[model samples]
Target: MKAVGTSESHADAVAICLTQADYKGHLCEGLYQLKTYVDEVEYGGCDKDAVPTILKESPVCAWVDGNNGLGVIVANFSMNLAIQKAKKCGIGWVVAKRSNNYGIAGMYSLKALDAGFLGLSFSNATPLVAPSRALEGALGANPISVAAPATNEDYFLLDMSTATVAHGKVEILGRKKLPVPTEWANPVTGALTPLGGSDPSSNYKGFGLAMFVEILCGILGDSGYGPYVRRYGDVHQAANIGHCFIAVNPNYFAPGFEERLSDLMNYIRNMQPADPERPVIVPGDFERQHMSTVDHQGGICYAKDLVKICQMLADRLNVTHLSPLI
Candidate 1:
């Protein structure tokens, strides 16, 4: 896939570049697809504008109208606004409606962390989850993402859907032309399992969180809920998905919030290793490790087909081509 460099520092640049590629590859693709068929797009009554004006509207927020513009670009624009507001006013919030798939929630939350503010993001997706037991789909796999700064290490990012595994992970597998893990999907009915999904492991906890997000983003915002929510990538229908973002300045609660966060994390770090070599892990640990691996390997990997699709879109938009990460 195409990649580009930014003036930000190494870590910051890595995060930014990855997010940029993801936006173009995932979100932009969906937007371009939607725009082809739809005549008018509405975002809380606002029409399309470049990324800048979208961010200026602030807390009451703004919408893309998508006309259906790229939801990824729209979402990226909106989340960036949240990060900016948090940096200046100690917190920022944004919610997006009539937007399509905007890629990973972590990418957005991490934006706030990169900007030195704690980032909190949540979005409600089309209904794919069943509450606890019943088979019929009634709830969503609503997801939550958070990122906080850590002085001794990379930022701590926690990104997960309330469901057992995010539908995105499943979609990633589908994109790979690979079969989903046996545990991850129901073999018999082709239905996705909920967080608890009969495993009784951490799935239930995820399921609960998914429900919580559904309420916060969907119910609270008065967006479509339950069976009414539409699916993504469906050219025939509009995606009425909703999202919520909350950015908080640690300095507001305590003068040395970052220091305190580091200290608390240190305490957890020094705990006896479950295995002497493996050591204990914390939130954001896996993603941080993944980033390092990608760096050493010279670049991150994306599905080759997806890369081609991105090139095709870049050609269509007449935007300059993006260089590969390597």
Candidate 2:
């Protein structure tokens, strides 16, 4: 990112965020988005050196202006402030406007979890999803993530897009010339419900979740919402993307929260599987498995195409191409 003119701190922030995405196996949000972010900075949609500033604040909340900065930096700053506020007041909510896309919503939520608080994060994104029954796109693939700690450093992390899938995943399938699954952004049925079926009967639930995120991040953050958000990959002007981060201390509500959460998760994990070969898993289990694999391998093993993409980016920036370690 620094090679593409991002400031050192901002570059670090973006790199760290993407690295987490890769570790968690959300490749679309990880190294895959690096070139796009470079385009955003270079083409004038985002300011490389801009700093996020708090616009208003109370003991338990804050409003921030991202100053058209990189989303990773803006999100980090806002969530950090929220964590600090939560430390004193038992809860904190911070919202920011004029930020670019953050890598993944779970990254911010986990920050609070690491700080011994439950975290929920949301962000309004480029408009690509149509609301239920709409002919054209009217809503962003607004994402929501919640992370709660359990015993022995375990956690319950729920991170998902309000849309059937985020646009990046669509682009990924398109690039590979692979057929996208029906529930993975099927235009025929439109958006799928969060319940995992393409059945239109429950589709409104997905639309409602999208609206929930838009209301908090876009409206509350004082950023663009609905059609007001810029189209994806449009570098024509600044994007008024919005994000919201929340941290809440469980001690304020109940005692032994982590223990209770652990018990619940363990019980769920031990339940009988519908298919004997595939066991039911909890929210963060998939990500945890991915992380474990990455750890065992000592690093992420990029696809051949991904490495080629990185080489192209390196050449574009007049930087040395990264070589495989093994």
Q: Pick the candidate with the highest lDDT.
A: 2
* Best model per TM-score: 2
Stretches off by above 4 angstroms in model 1 are 1-68, 84-89, 168-182, 199-202, 302-326
| RMSD to native, candidate 1 | 6.8
Residue-by-residue lDDT tens digits, candidate 2, 1-326: 78767878788888898888999988879988988888898889999899999999999999999999999989989999999999999999999999999989999999999999999999998877767666567788888999999999899999988887667777767779887776666556343333233546576888888899999999988899988988877985888999999999999996999999999999999999999998889999999999999899988988888889889999999998987878
**Model 2 local distance difference test score:** 0.87
Candidate 1 structure quality by residue, lDDT tens digits, 155-189: 67777666666565676677677887744556554
**Alpha-carbon TM-score of each model against the true structure:** 0.70, 0.94
TM-score of 1: 0.70
Model 1 error, position 10 (Å) = 24
